[model samples]
Target: MLRYVINRIIVALPVLFGVLVVTFFLIRLIPGDP
Candidate 1:
């Protein structure tokens, strides 16, 4: 259903944001810039 899809997307947004933040920090921690 449309509502289910919307709910899933809402839930995934935070997880996606978390992943982006973690990745950004991890990349910054690398010894050399890419």
Candidate 2:
């Protein structure tokens, strides 16, 4: 159980990082009018 959770976190970290980076770049590219 604990090992499974740890492995899941390890696998998810890179994916989460990628998403965050992409979103950051997208926000930067978009206009600032909301």
- Candidate 2 stretches with Cα past 4 Å from truth are none
Task: Report the lDDT tens digits of candidate 2 across residue range 1-34.
Answer: 9999999999999999999999999999998888
User: Which pairs of residues have clashing backbones in candidate 1?
Assistant: none
Query: Model 1 over residues 1-34: C-alpha lDDT tens digits?
Result: 9999999999999999999999999888887855
Give the C-alpha miss distance for residue 25 in model 2, angstroms. 0.3
Error of 2 at 29 (Å): 0.7
lDDT against true structure, model 2: 0.98
TM-score of 2: 0.82
Question: C-alpha displacement of 16 in model 2, angstroms?
Answer: 0.8
- Global local distance difference test of model 1: 0.95
Each candidate structure's count of clashing pairs: 0, 0
Question: In candidate 2, what residue range of length 10 has the lowest lDDT sum?
Answer: 25-34
